[model samples]
Target: MSDPFTFQMLVNYLIIGAGLMALGTLGFLSRRNMIVMFLSAEMMLQGTALTLVAFGRYHGNWTGQIFTIVILTVAACEASIALALILILFNRKSSLDVTLWNEIREPGQPAIVEDPAEAEATEPVPGVESYPVLTPAGIEPEHQTWTVHRD
Candidate 1:
């Protein structure tokens, strides 16, 4: 049989779960990318599930595991729906930035619009691309020009 779950272990699990929840909350609040936000939300859910499982195990009951399973099912459904919404939103906006979605806010709410000058200032500088660059490989072959005569 496995060693019994101790109070120290439970505390440790709770701490880790809390950390994950905090990180997820920070990511969800600070990031502007839709996909990143979605992932953050999932992280938060996972943290909650972890805490539930830890508590259930510490209490010597099946409740935590069962709740975690239910959470997983809900997360799976949420994933499919969220992905579809993201795809549809991307198709309409051509961007994954959440700031572009202010138009969908509640009717009574004022739209949040960025100033043109500030937007320009925030734009990425040219020649400093974020992606990696590949160098050319091998030598270029010489080509012979052939003349065609028509009669």
Candidate 2:
């Protein structure tokens, strides 16, 4: 059995994890692209997982490993949701830049149009609209639906 508080080894791992976390945070805060921000979030989670696993191994404890597994599950769900959002944003505006996504500023309000003429001149896409439509079954309002896996 190893001493979990071995100062030198613990300090080394902590420093490495802290550095990774700082870099991830910077990347997330400084980037406007949603994809880069999501990747940075993943990096932050990876750093956390590394720290958790290192502590688990050092202490011969299972709790940290279990926590790491929970983090992994959360990360998976986060990534899936972020990817779905990115696809939808891209489909709508043809850009993944977060700066371009200021359409909805208030709840229960239709997204603001960038140019009134553009909105009026163009024929609307079949399923795309300024507001999502509610279905009788309480499904995600139709305009908000995106095929997760379209053939």
Candidate 3:
């Protein structure tokens, strides 16, 4: 509770946070695997949280801690959603590569081809987008009546 956060310690925390952010950015950019990319995003979140906690500690306020909690909560939700989606994606393609999604574009859309020089570490594939088409259960609402005009 009375721990003093010296300038040196603050700087170290900031530096470490910055490093984590940079690493996460790099990994998110260079990797094509969905899981890996998500992991990188988590890393970035952790880094930002770390920086927030450091600042909050230095200022002797709960703002940083509160923000960190929110960040962690968001990260957890994101991870859970991402994992579920990844499982679905893996089931569809039988792999965790990201490049396979390039083909799921509009008609005549050029396939997304990653330059080997830019990101040679990831894999690739071709795919189509499919979604359930739902029919209206009742009478459609009129769009004109839904509009609100303010004078």
| TM-scores, one per candidate | 0.73, 0.63, 0.68
Which tens-of-lDDT digit does each residue in 10-106 have in candidate 1?
9999999999999999999988889999999999999999999999999999999999999999999999999999998877777788888898899
Error of 2 at 8 (Å): 1.6
For each candidate, the alpha-carbon lDDT, in order, equals: 0.88, 0.79, 0.86
Candidate 1 — which residues are off by over 4 angstroms? 115-151
The per-residue C-alpha lDDT of model 2 at residue 10 equals 62
- lDDT leader: 1
- Give per-residue lDDT, candidate 3, residue 125: 38
Ranking by lDDT: 1, 3, 2
Inter-residue clash pairs, candidate 1: none
Tens digit per residue, CA lDDT, model 3, 1-151: 5667988888999999999999999999989889889989999998999999999988889999999999989988998999999988877777677887778778998888756577445443344334445787988887763323322
Itemize residue pairs with steric clashes in candidate 3.
Answer: none
